[model samples]
Target chain A: MAARILIAEDEPYIVESLRFLLGREGHSVESVNDGAAVQARLETYKPDLLILDIMLPEMTGFEVLRRVRESEITKALPVLVLSAKGQESDQQRMADLAANDFVMKPFSNRDLINRVTALLPAKTLAGSGQAPAAVEAPMSSDRE
Target chain B: MAEISTGQRIRELRQHRGIAQSLLAEQVDISPSYLNLIEKDKRKIGGALLHRLAQRLEVSPAQLSGVEDASLVRDLVDIARVLSFDGLDEAIAGRLVAQAPDWGQAMVTLFQRYKDASETATALSDRLSQDPQLRELSHAVLTQISSIRSFAEILKDVPDLPQDERAHFSGIIASQADRLGLSAREMIALLEGNPGDEIERSQAASAVHEVEDLVNAQRNHLPHFETAADDLRRRILAAHGEGSITAAMLAHLETKHDVEVRQVEGDAFEGLVEEGVHLVDLAAPRTATRFDIARRLMAMELREEIEELARNDRLSGEDARQVARRAFANYAAGALLFPYVPFLEAAEHYRYDMDRLAQRFDGSFEQIAHRLTTLRRPGAEGIPFAYLRSDPAGNISKPYSLPGLRMPRLGGACPLWAVYAAFAEPHKTVAQFAAMPTGERFLFVARRVAKGAQAAGAAPAAYSIMLACEASYANRLVYGDPFTGGREATVTPVGFTCRTCSRQNCGQRAQAGILQRA
Candidate 1:
């Protein structure tokens, strides 16, 4: 489905790849390096899905997710946390923070696309009928 | 619990029954002086004498021996040690427990709380400060891998990528690989225990904790040292003009006390006194040199006073006493450099601008920061500020906090503190309003200060010093100028440490709070 996504990651290389990949998936992408800017951009950019990084400066993705869930306007904003801290406790904490999905660092390209597509608002998916082939392309080959 | 002699127990029972010492001795068929010695635990009693004493006191022989109260006394003494209740030996513990078992049980519950809180703090400190190298290395490696993986997948999946784009992604992957290799090597080195011996570090930490407890017990103020420092400062100002206090101190040391001052190249000891020569680090800043000289002067002029203060009853053992001696000397030096009334007046006048006070007093950033903590004079006090200094790696030293604000005794503080943030912007003051779980808010001011002169390529030795005072007193400091309204949202909720803090749903929480129910 075509949607707007915000990538709240610090690494330029990761952001660049995500921008390119998500752009190809027919999603408009905006990126910020730190957590505070994520909150600031959420109001203006208003991305359908937020890709959060856990180790962001100023605030962690966990804190951003918490505030996102608390505010009335952005309470239901779908969040997909991309993190290097992939411990069981972190996963539980992200779940408690109401993150829609979690993709660990050194992630497979196909897996990330699938999660992103799945986390986008169901209304967008219903309107668009189905996601792009890039979303499912890695699913079959990722098994190999 | 303390062990009580059977004779002592008999005497206590007799006293409880309102029997005179001579009457009890006569009833027990012993001389009064002999009974006195026995009551003092100097003489032993058993067999027929023990039975007779027990009968006269209306108790059994075993009760007279205090065998039933042995465990209670042990627990009381243990509790006393944990609470830092000075001089609570087994003898006193026995007396307290024997006299009132209900009060003894109350003490046991109090000790339980103290034990739980201390355990949580110690566990959190160990988790955060211990093996920091490993945590850093692992995070670095993972970050590098994430970058590498994204770029590599882009290269592999996007066969139709442009030439320049492909080259950029490839270059990034190569560099990230290099960094990953370096991180892996560092992690291996850390696993091999190359950093330091754990046992030695923990032993030193306990001694440091003892000294901190002693200082904290005294409210971080010593009037005796303050008086001597004031007198010495007057003598220095009178004998040698304030134009050069260091030179004047040197003259004072040399002429009055036959001591020689020498400065050697490179950073070493701040001031190492061997024989009659005082070797000061040549690379040390003027502030440190002057402070060291002042401390040396204090040691020379008031050695007896310093020694007496170091013998504080609160200090546990000789090691803690030795640490206290150095701490007391440093406190004396801070008082000498920044005399109580003048420093407090300047601090109030300047609204506690540390840099301005540093310039006014010719003190370093750290010297000024520490001096600010010693402003607890009755009826003439500045803001009561808690002081903490953390290295880049997050190990905190010389942590002092007010009553409501708890400071970690052994290791690093919570990662959410501005002290950690201060490292990101070296030399720039970072201030924040942090609220603890206890609903206490503090305005914390932090800045990274260089420790000593850096040798080329050797990692710069620096630490961030943070001073925190109650938020209510924020209006008195320049750092709190912008946040005078005390906006609730602007206050960042923080914790003492992860294990001890009971804040719920905190994203940065490292461990479940000990207070939380399963």
Candidate 2:
């Protein structure tokens, strides 16, 4: 599936790898290096999904999530929270803030790809089984 | 209620009256040797002999039985244990406290102040050497690890990547590893007690810690306070009828105690008592108003009982005892307002919900939280919960720990705990399952509560209150329901303090763990 994805991360090489991997997978990706730039970039980029790093500089991923959830235009955007903390409390906190999915850093590339595919709008990705009900309905119920 | 040793009190009264030991023993119809043994605490003296001794001493038997000089004797005994002399023993220490209390008290106070000052000096030195520098080094190391992990994974996975990208990734990894090595060396330097890090040791005494020691020694449960509170509650309900506890307290104060309760505006103090006129700030919250009234009533009604409870060996001096008096009064007021039996029943029925209990008992959130710690009433006790209160700056003001859950004594607690998170969203309760480095798991619920009445333009006094119990007991609490008795709870790794915790990989650790340093 090809979708507009926004990556909010502080690490440059990590961003480069993400951009390379996602662009090769046919997704159009835009990136912001800090949390403070994410909101403005989200408004301009209007991406279908946001990959957020929890420890972004200037502002935190938590503050960004709070603001995104509060904004009417971006409230329903699917979010994949990334963190290095690797604690269950962090995962639960992300879930509580309505993030679509949470992935600890040092995550598997294959798993990240699958989760991002699952979180993208169903119309943009056919045969994806895990399109959450709050997002658009799955076009085809092909369980993987 | 034998607050004092009858033998000790007897000896003191006899000495005060200037009665010779042989004459007193003859009047009391006991052998002089037997009286001497009793006065030395070698033998018990009570019943008819005690009454006779009091009669000869020209004091009531209650006075002889109620002095709490046993605590003094215990202090003297402790002093003797630490500073042993040729002829000193437990008997001589008891005799010292009984015969010359002023000298005994002065020695005990002096010894205790010395110990406290030494401990404070040690703790201050530890903080100065380790706290800030450790935090900075740990952050640098953790950040380096995060970057190194990501880049290393990228390098390993992307074999077909361009040459320049691979070399750039390799260069980043090497530099981060260098930074990590540097941080490790700095950590070693910190642990080895690097010089030029001395802190002022002038502030030695803390009456708060003394009271905390006393409370912790008793496991935060005082049966005497509970009984006094119950008696006061019953009397007020009987005299003033059953409406609200605050109303009943007001009526009881006005009718029985002859106290004039008045609401005053723009008072600097929240509550003040002078000339039998009780002034309560009109701007104070209703709960504060009721709490002040209840505290005043308890202080008035149970003064002697509270005093007896305060006469503990744990208290170092008058300041500690004075602090303990106020704390005891507040405790008695909580007991009076909640009335243990009914409160415990409600707590069980409501699944230990703080909000529900506060609503049912007409108390504030902090009051309900405080009452939760006092439920250690033997067989019918509630879950053993530790209580902690902290301000925004992470200064722990009130800390009560259960057996397995240790509260940090000298420094800030681990930043990852839910108690700190509660500060971000005031009044919103945050529940979490946290596991200590010792592998002990706890279910914690914390919320930021308003401290007291807010003045118009004041910065608003607020602090976070937390109640935590072993994860096994989480099933009994409403806040722990989502974790389903803590069986399936997702656990967050935590520590008592970063300096002592053994978990080396914790991203939030401020200092190298003791084991890590070693």
Which numbered prediction scores highest in DockQ against the true structure? Answer: 1
Model 1 C-alpha lDDT per residue in residues B473-505, reported as the tens digit of each score: 999999998778857778889988775578888
Q: Which parts of model 1 are misplaced by more than 4 Å?
A: A1-144, B1-202, B267-274
- Give model 1's TM-score for chain A to 2 decimal places: 0.83
Query: Please, what is the whole-model Cα lDDT of each candidate in the order they appear?
Result: 0.73, 0.72
Candidate 2 lDDT, B308-425, residue by residue in tens: 8789776756767888999999998999999999999999999999999999888999999899989987567888889999888987877887655766544578899999999998
Angstrom error of the Cα, residue A37, model 1: value is 68
Residue B290, model 2: lDDT of 91
iRMS (Å) per candidate: 5.9, 8.0
TM-score for candidate 2, residues paired by index: 0.50
Calculate candidate 1's fnat.
0.63
